[model samples]
Target: MRQQIVEAREKAAKDGIRVQRARTPAPDVAAPVGEVTEATEPFQDNGTLRTISARYDLTGQRELLWIANEGKKVGDARCTQKFQFSNNTTPRERPTMLLCWRTSQDKSVVVLAVTPEGRPDTRDAVAKLDTRWSAMG
Candidate 1:
């Protein structure tokens, strides 16, 4: 099943679609949860303009970027959102990260990463992270 998803992503990339595999921060790492310091900024995602909601230096490695439905604070309940995949034969729960332009030929957003738990579905804290890399916040 994972292989099928990989193949599909590869096909999309070949067609000019951007797919991002979100990286999970190590369990032992910790960082400050910062406030939103900039207004929504416009960025080029594969030549399309997309707006970024906020950015923070969560891990000090890179600025965490996000797009929220409305104004929100750092580490607030609304900071994270749920995304479901089309495949659901096993009804597994996985945390995923996605970003993209609202309008595009494929209407496909970049899938940054997906992590599945061995046990019951547990929400991944990484999905709520501010790990997006951007030049301007």
Candidate 2:
């Protein structure tokens, strides 16, 4: 997992995009299980800044609640167990997508992808992360 993040950063740099560690404040909710691992970076996409982030090791109903609450704070949030992804968008502001799933290793994961309003939807970006991370055990 760490390797993937490193490769992503390197790839962004090679593409002439400046990627920076996301500086958003952590959510107020506390995790009750294993330590949560997070990796986030904001980079330029077609002249617009976009963000991609992931949190790992979440394991409980409380964590799911946290995800739901956080998504609600942003926009109309919807979660699907089958797809293991959440959709949240603030059409008045930005478009964001959140995905959560239990890995083969039994670890719960959440990923977020965001793009400025007026840009394309974040489905593709979130889907890419879903495909990449879902394979990790």
TM-score of each model, paired residue for residue: 0.22, 0.35
Candidate 2 versus the native: TM-score? 0.35
Candidate 1 per-residue C-alpha lDDT over 23-73 given as tens digits, one digit per residue, 9 for 90 to 100: 344467674454433233222232212223323334311222333333123
lDDT of 2 at 125: 40
Instruction: Return the lDDT, model 2, position 105.
Output: 38
Off by over 4 Å in 1: 30-137
Colliding pairs, model 2: none
lDDT score for residue 31 of model 1: 41
- What Cα-based lDDT does every candidate model obtain? 0.32, 0.41
Model 2 gets an lDDT of 0.41
